[model samples]
Structures are given as C-alpha cells and as structure tokens.
Target: MSEEDYRIGLIHATVNSVQPILDAFQVHAPQVTLVNFMDESLIFELNETGTVTKNMARRLLNLVEKAVMSGVDGVLLTCSSFTPVVSEISHLFDVPMLSADVSMLEKAVDMGTRIGVIATVEAAGPTTTALLEKIASKRQKDVTFKTVIIPDAFKALQNGDRTKHDKLIHQKVQELANDCDVILFAQFSMARALETLDMTTTPPILTSPEISVKSIVAKISKKEIVI
Candidate 1:
C-alpha cells in the first residue's frame, strides 16, 4: 500500500488547471500516480450559457465513472463551475470523490463572514457563491460572499500569456484582499499563480488544488482503497 502505487484521477474543466494540480501533488504527494482527464470545452460551454444543463451534469458523472473504471483509487474534480454536478455524483461511487472548491470554501467561511471569491470565469462565480451560501446556512452563519469575475485573465491564460494572466489575478487578489476578510480563488487554474504571488497585500488567500490533493491523498491512504 505504498503511495507510489496509488492512482488518483483528476478531472479538469481546462488544461490550465492540471499543471497547478500536478505541481501541488509534486510537493504534497509525489508518489501518487495521476491519471488526468481534461475537457477544456466544458468551461467555455458553461461560461457561455451561465448554467449547468441536464446533459452537462450527466457528462460530469460519466467522466467520473470513466475515471473509476480506469482503476483510480479516488477522484478529485478540479472544476469549480461544476459544483452542483459533483454533489449529485460524489456519493454514487464508493471511492472518495471531492469537489474542487469545497474545502477552500468551507475554510473561507470559517475564517470570517465577509468572503471574496475571485473567479476568471462567469460560470464559476455563481456555483461557488451558491456553495458558500449553502454551507453558511447549514451552520446558521450570517455570511456575505462577493464574487469578482475577470474573464480577461482566463483569456490571457488560454492564449499562453501566463504573465498577463498571473498579473491580472494578482492585481485582483490585492484588491479583494483589501475588501474582504478572506479571499478564495474560485478556479483550479488560478491556483497555479499562488506560489509566485506576493501576498503582502492580500488577506489569507486559499486555492483549491493543494487542499484537494491533500484531502484525496488522505482518503486513499487511510482506506488503502483500490478500484
């Protein structure tokens, strides 16, 4: 039951998120083998319509089923916009299934009442804000979540202008950090820039990839589960 033998599946909305997830695993769980499933079009499709269709939810479940069939020990979903889909399907599989932003979202709410969720896509904002609201309601906590969507940064990253993308995110993070009690980067892709970010100006910024990876690793290791 060595970590090297464990296989974890990562499903991404776009290719941009994979590198950051991989980079995070390299630090936190280097031995866990990764099987990545990327559907870059999913993010674009969701953003265009600003809602998750029935077919889209089915596709998300299908992808997770596909990953389980591939012999993964656990699955970590790296798309924030698919938050609702994840909730429907997580319990469908015996293996641990984690929604990308839940841990960060919970932690943000725990930190304070005023939460700033920064997303580079429109679709991500609604789903994540809704999630935080649900959690807040469950805990009977009065919380206000403000979402800031910056699709320009997302476009820059898609076009290979990472410097522009990171700069754009950093500027927004600084601004959000000043306004809110805690900042949660809403997309998995945004986690890539976390390391290089100068955090002097931001409040405690939380990203999903690292926390998700760590949670998945804990699940697989604790259960020594296999598909």
Candidate 2:
C-alpha cells in the first residue's frame, strides 16, 4: 500500500486485540490504511485496578487528539472500558471517533437480549454490560446482560502466557454458553482467543475489529474521499 492509500488512524491503549482486527480489516477493505499507537501509562492504570483512571483518560486523549490533528479520516479506539473518554473524544474531533464496544454491542443486541460479555480486565465486563443495557433500553429491546470476568486471563496475557490465556478464555466462554443467548468479547486484545478456542457450544460471538472499522468507514466515506 502507498502512503496515499492509507487513510484511517486507529488509536489503541494496547495491541492485544488489534492484531486480528488489522488482518481482517486489510482483507475486508484493502484500500484503507490503519495506524496504531499506545499510551504506555494507560496499560499500567488498567492493570492496577483492571479499570481506567483520570490519568489514563488524559493520556489516551493526548494520543487520540494528535491522531486527529494529523489529518486522519477517522479514529477508532480499541479499548472497551474507555467509553467515557471515547464519547468525549468523538464529540471533540471533527472526524468520526468510535468506540470499539459501542459498535460491537449494536451487533450483539441485534442477535439477542440475553447477552454474555466476556472481558480480560475485571472492569470491562461490567462496563460493557452497562453499555449494552443502555443501548437496549434506547432501542426499546428487552435485554439483560450477564458479565463474566476471566480470572487471570489478563494477567496471563500481560505475562506473555498466550497458551494459558487462550485456555482460560475458552473455558470461560464455554461456561457461559449454558446461560447467555449470545457471547460478546469485551476487550480488543482478546480477539485472538476467539479463533484459538472452540466456541461450538456458545452462542454467536462478536468482536470489535470488523464492526468498528466498518462504522468508521461509513462515517468517513460520507465526509471525505477514500484513498
């Protein structure tokens, strides 16, 4: 791809879930370009309590604002729990700013009301559950969210234990199959776990990559020419 072919800028706090999304995005939309960067401080803040802090949002905004200022066509944040800041950033920027969670949650709601949100971080599970419930109410769909936090899954990923992380996530998703109407992966970095695990027993699973990229593509195409 040439410099002129690349156009979209993706802002991520971490790279875990961004890998597969990039692969899929390239295959799904070959003409668009994606750029990723990390705010090292947000990783520490998220891991400290498995949640975002005031400082984390500040650091994230600094990176995302710069991406917008650089003349990118659109911005998609890969972090799920940072929706508060994501909402604020989307409004502040002229270009489309999207949340990885909101895009995927819309898809999940369309599938069913009894949804299971699985996340690597402790906070992501509840945060996503709340967001889905809100979306469901706004759409007037009767919905309930079942949240499961995969214990040690984030630690395994953080510790570089890919195999263990995959195993734990698979087990958690499997257990949820008995309860939820659909399974939704909450963290962006956990996308690899979906391909690694056998989700035959669980309901349909939704990830951030395709949903978010597609939404941003639609939002940008109307406002600017695609490279």
- The numbered model that scores best in lDDT is 1
lDDT of 1 by residue, 77-183 (tens): 98888877877888789788888888888888899999998899888888889899999999999998778899999999999998998898888888777679998
| Displacement of the residue 129 alpha carbon in candidate 1, Å | 0.9
RMSD of each candidate?
2.0, 2.7
Clashing pairs in 1: none
Cα shift from native, residue 221, model 2 (Å): 1.4
TM-score of each: 0.93, 0.91
| Model 2 worst lDDT run, 10 consecutive residues | 1-10
Q: What does candidate 2's lDDT look like per residue over 1-227, in tens digits?
A: 33345477777777675686687687677678777767755765776776677777778888887887777877887788787678765677787778877878988998987898888887787789888988898899998787888859878887889999989988888888988888888977888887787765678888887777778777676566544
Please give the CA lDDT of all the candidate structures: 0.86, 0.78
lDDT of 1: 0.86
Q: Which candidate gets the maximum TM-score versus the true structure? A: 1
